[model samples]
Target chain A: MDSIEHQDHPDRELLEMLQEAEAKVEQLRVELDRRREFRRQMRADEAHEGTDEEVERLSEYLEQAQINWQAVRKFFQSAIEEYRADDAWGSGRPGA
Target chain B: MSQTIRDESTDSEHGVRQIEVDGADTAAPASPLRRLPLTGRPLRIVEWLAVVAAIYVMITAVGAIGSGFEAATGGQAEELFSFASNPFVALVIGILATALTQSSSTTTSIVVGMVAGGLPIEIAIPMLMGANVGTTMTSTLVSLGAASDREQFRRAFSAASVHDMFNLLAVAILLPIELIFGVLGTIADWFAQLTTGTDGGIVTTIFTAFGDAVSAVTSPGADLIEAAVMGILPEVIGGVLMILLGIALILLIIKFIANMLKSLLVGRAERIFHAAIGRGPISGIGSGALITVMVQSSSTTTSLTVPMAASGKFSLWQIYPFTVGANIGTTMTAMIAAFGFSGVEGTAAMTAAAVHLIYNLFSATIIFAVPFLRPLPVKGAKWLGDLGAKNKMYVLFWLGGLFIVLPAVLIGVSTWVF
Candidate 1:
């Protein structure tokens, strides 16, 4: 009679385990949101610290740096994209 | 409960897919670097056409001078060169004409033509020697650009003047031997005979073709100019005009070509010189030969090297082989001149040119191959450079005396006494 009762109660334990996992996932999502907001505020503060001329010059330099980085990133990303596209096409599937 | 679980799994998968799509879209745009559709500038076409036009103008100018010479001489071209019968006078004329024109080719071609037209080889040989000496003046003149900077001027002038010293030394050593023993002349004549089956040889054949082509273009205009000027001004006036025009054309061509080359090859040339200097004398000689060949003039090669030397990019030792190589390279003009005449006369003229080439080659072989002879010119040049550094006026005097005053005095005395 005791064995029969243990078998019938298995679904309850499974539900409790799922609830615990969902709670952990929610905590992780909140941490990620805080990190993103902190990064955005730091960037805004940096953008506000200079006199107009100095700010303009800094902005120009930052823009150029950004452009260069973007160019480099684009080059690598495009290469990867090309490889993936080629592989997918070669496999005769839409997103292989 | 199973349905709820399935919905949650699907939602997470959809979120992950959304994030990936967003990341892909945010990955910066493809490289803005595109291959420029236009491979070369349009101005290149204009530059090439300009070069072609300049060449045509140069040929025309040369034609004009030939016509003027024919008109001035009035079929007495042979009589006109009678003064060159004296070897010393011929040598002086060679030096003066080349100095005035600033071109060894012009002087050499004239000498070859004169020789082919019945001027004695003995007379032409001296002229050939004079052309060798006179060619050095171009670099000497080039040194003047650095005159404002005393230290630079001293170095540049010395480098430029060293060529004059070398040529003078060669002439001093070889000329007396040539006059007394006829060693160079004999050897040259023998070689000429072997190659051309006559003293004037194959070079004369080429010169004849050149002369004919020149005559065909210029004779009609020359005849008309002669007819117009014969009564009003002396025939000499027309000749003078021709000479002037020829000179102007040559100067213009040289200036343009030099600027073009400097713009095109100066960076590469600097690198090459730096590398060649480290490789030693053989490399130096090869560099000198190659640069002169590309420039089509040894004076240009030597003159260009002076500035590099002045700037301390090269030492006197490195430059020595270059000068020797230039001496050999310059004789190519005379060979080209030989092609302008035909028959026995052309052969003789070509032989004279060959003599010039052989003389330089032999001198290089003797000086460079043997350790003893190599340092003489270098030592002399350094000594002169030291003197030039102390008294800047010495540069002018050296040029004036060696290329001008001395040659003129020697020729005048020879003419008077002989």
Candidate 2:
């Protein structure tokens, strides 16, 4: 009796197709949510990396403080004028 | 007879030849590139003989000074060198004398002789340290040659000043200990006692034999000179004149020997120096000391490194140990000078010489072994070199401040303020 009844229904196939489409939409929505979360994590990692670079820059600046680079540069400016390149004595100097 | 011959010929090794003109414009052909003279067997023999002669004269001169000093003061020599009794004055004298002569070996050897002639051991000890400090002046001067190029001058000056810094720091540390504890004098005397036989050491026999042989060869000349001077002038005046003559002879002969030896040993020494560089600090120091001993001049040993430093062949740290080694090697001259004396005089002289050796070795051992202390000289030198490279005025100020004004100020303080 039941078999005869089901076989008689005209919209039964269409209803099954609609159910499959809804399941696919839920799967797609979960994937989109994962991608958005991953994007946020990557941005956080980039910000942390930038901080490290800033720390290194500051350390370098501090090291330069120990020696008066301004004075050294100023002196080099004048010294370069008087500096001469003479190989009069080099590696061949006797009494080595 | 000339031992060296000159020739104008092509040298494939150096590709050095006379310049040529394209068309017979013949402006006197440029002087041919000539090679340094090659040494023959006869020349080697002559060189060795000259070396022996120099040593003979040097020892003879030392003896003359000792006897002359004794006679002049009538065995009460305390007052004669009284001004130098203050350790600071003695130190300044050592620095000034060594700087002017450009030879610490000469200064240290003279100090040994003066000690043998009754200069108080306390005074001689500081002078020995000063002589070590003063020897660095030679390399500093050599580095000035590269002053035209900022980088080269910086490197050269740093290399050279590492030596000066190490020595000056050593003095700053040791002199105070030396003053308060007098440890150098005590240790020096102990060794002196070993050679002099007060402690029954077998070295006494060897030391005596060496001294006797030296006396036999050198005494006649010294005696004849003393007798001739004494014959005409009063004993005191003759003594003074003999002392002056002895000093003159020592200065002249030492210069001659240094020049001769430098010419002979330079190539061999250069090879040794190359082999040792970059090996480590120990090898650097060892080769430095060895080359200095071979050529008999610490100045020559240290000056050669200035060029290498400027050329970037080695770092300042690498050359630092070598300079220290030169300091060690130069102590040999004082030891040799000490051997020419015997008895109480011998003991005093030997103690002074030993102090020179001990002070250098001890300072080197302490500074190099300590991780923190090792870089002190290098850092100080780098700072100074950087400053010097920036302005020529700094270099002049350094020369004046460290060598002249500082020592002068110390002398004044030691003499009057104290």
Residues B110-153, model 1: lDDT tens digits: 55544554556777788888887888877776765554455775
- What DockQ would candidate 1 receive versus the native complex? 0.01
- Among these predictions, the greatest TM-score belongs to 2
Sorted into a CAPRI-style docking class, model 2 comes out as: incorrect
lDDT by residue for model 1 over A8-89, one digit each (tens)? 7657677667888999999999999999999977864453323222211211221121113343344335334535565321
Total clashing pairs for each candidate: 13, 2
Clashing residue pairs found in predicted model 2: A83-B148, A84-B148
lDDT of model 2 at position A17: 79
Candidate 2, residues B234-317: lDDT per residue as tens digits?
988998888888888888877677656654454345446545644578887888898888767788777766766776646787
lDDT of 1 at B64: 48
How would you encode candidate 2's per-residue C-alpha lDDT over A1-96 as one tens digit per residue? Answer: 233238666776776677789999999999999999999778645533333222222212212212233544544444333433221223232211
Computed on C-alphas against the true complex, the DockQ of each candidate is: 0.01, 0.02
What range of 10 consecutive residues in model 2 chain B has the weakest lDDT sum?
Answer: B24-33
**When superposed on Cα atoms, how far off is each prediction in RMSD?**
28.8, 17.7
Which docking class does model 1 fall in?
incorrect
